[model samples]
Target: MIIEIKIPTPGESITEVELGKWLVDDGSIVSKNEEVAEIESDKATLTLVAPETGKISFKVEEGVTVAVGELACTIDTDAAGEVALDPPVAAQPKAEPETIKTEASTEKTSSADQRRIKTTAVAREIMEEHHLSVDDIIQGLQRIGKKEVEAVINQPTSTQKMESAPKNLFSRDESREKMSMLRRKLSQRLVAVKNETAMLTTFNEVDMSPIMEIRKQFQNKFIEKHGLKLGFMSFFTKAVATAMQFHPAINSMIDGEEILTPQFVDVGIAVQTPKGLMVPIVRNAESKSIPAIELEIKELAEKARSKKISVEELTGGTFTITNGGTFGSLLSTPIINPPQSAILGMHNIVDRPMAVDGQVVIRPMMYLALSYDHRIIDGKDSVGFLVKVKSLLEKPQLLLTDGKLPEELLLEL
Candidate 1:
């Protein structure tokens, strides 16, 4: 009745993976198909689920590398009901009304008061022993004395404390951790990209007022209809996809002396997770509506962060988009994801004075950086591609017509 669980292969090339962590403790009852632990491969993080409802036992410790198909744990289906459960609430004594009221009042105290109060270790222990808080002790105090006022006056100011504090306290302490396979692989790929490719970055800026206005005006309707809010990434994603039509070379990659241009645009969105950065592709982005792109990006980003995304979801991207704007990066030349000829980097928006119709106008603007393999893509292609993206983003309506004006498409010009 014991079922042995083996490590699942994350990908074709991943021979081994590090045991990321266990979701449940050993000897705990797990439901059938319940995720028990996560395995970290160089490409992605994958979860191991229980084959059947059972009490599980761990065979390997977390953070240890194990070969694919190696035994990870075992679940004894026969011992499913052996684990004890907590007693019913009725079996325990109920709290008295006064005690419950006091606890409730303590919980209702303002968070600022909770943070502002400082207590000695001994005083904190006594307060805990009597189920008391700073507020409760304050309420019980008979009166404040001259000594207390003196104590308050003598307290060191934050600036004084900072100046007096030792500079090297805990500074010499150091610790090291083994790099996860994913990070190691990422490091190798980054180095390979710098050394192997003739990479060049071109930059451009876009006025975000039009897109921001659209979002502000239609966000409610968009959310009501699509069940998701309008976001900048979707607009940019659609813009990049639409812009690719005008500059197809930006979507092409060099493949062993042959230039491979994919007919479809699978735009990989770079999602940062606790483990590492993962690029989950939005398949055929050029053809999808903005709502659809937003929904898919949401799902893929959620999956990537939760470590539930598959290797297939992370692969086969023709181009990649990374938004450093979310983290407040003003500008950065993003490195290209391998096999993809170009990557678009979106940076933080800033309100600056811009020249408009012979008048100085304040406008919200964002910097865009496109890094490409110069050996395959020329400066003209790179610059044109970026300018096209900027135009599409600035005039979001152009996305609907595949980077052309509605009149242009109607006129067949």
Candidate 2:
């Protein structure tokens, strides 16, 4: 019996997906539930597995967009697996292992085809200096260069000796790859955000000494208490959540001349995955504890990287936080994630000289950049929101120490 493999609906918003690549060749036997092809959707990449043990045949070519539930391939469940082995030859008897040569090539040195080469200007000059014929270098190169000319000049000009040795052209290896559907989607969205939004970025630096000191002191205890490693993400998420309440514009979205604001803050974390950049939201992030926030972030990031995160989790973000610091980037202007008016960019921390009580001292410092939609959020609010985040991060004990935010930190919205 032949089993039909159909595309499963990845999501409601995703009606179609591109067949990224076929992992197995046509008529190759595969086991049940074995991954046979990869499906690329707008949100992420998904695997298409063999439905039953069988020989598989592709019904659709790669990179073709097909609607949900459309036929992708077919598997022949009745077919047995084929085992291919090389043809055997008679063995040489009484031969020692080291004295025996395995085989001789059918295409010998004299049988090789000479390659045609295009000579460049520099090659011509070198060829003139070496007083060699064009054919001298043609057999060894596709494009003539000084090296090829030099090679030709060093070889013997005897026709008999030249005929005995067939020279091979130096070939450059290259590969061509088609872009994945997710990458195409990423490109389109990034360009759309750049053209459609009146984006502006504000920059500031924070002394990370306080946060680092706290982490160094209580990191073991914090992990023992929470069962999770103390990370800067939780701190930033908390800070951004607290900061968003004070500056509502940073959390608001512009929808066709209407400003849409959410009462709760849903922070989108930009997670880098093999698929591409994915922003998974932690819903109601404003209310979650630091430990809860960290765990959810860990789960979402792992899911995103594994391409198991749902489309729902990737959507509806109120604000985004992207840390280029993970890649050791000192500074970068992150573009705003659309619908969400602002995105905070975090950078690498470095020990730098800072002023403390009118005295210069070395402190751990990190640069923060907030890119916002200028059409909706004014410069003042953007700067104010970033400042609030900076202060919270610098003095995190005010919020993260006991899970209680001091009343003074809350700006009445």
- Residues 187-274 of candidate 2: C-alpha lDDT, one tens digit per residue: 9999999999999999999998888887899999998998978898988998899887778889999888799999899999999988
Model 2 vs truth, CA RMSD:
13.3
- Off-target runs (Cα >4 Å) in candidate 2 are 78-175, 222-227, 400-413
Q: What is the model-wide C-alpha lDDT for candidate 1? A: 0.83
| Cα lDDT of model 1 by residue, 187-297, tens digit | 999999999999999999999999999999999999899998899999888988888888999999988879999988999999999999999999999899989999999
What lDDT score is found at residue 68 in candidate 2?
A: 87
TM-scores for the candidates: 0.81, 0.73
Maximum-TM-score candidate:
1
Q: Give the worst 10-residue stretch by lDDT in candidate 1.
A: 92-101
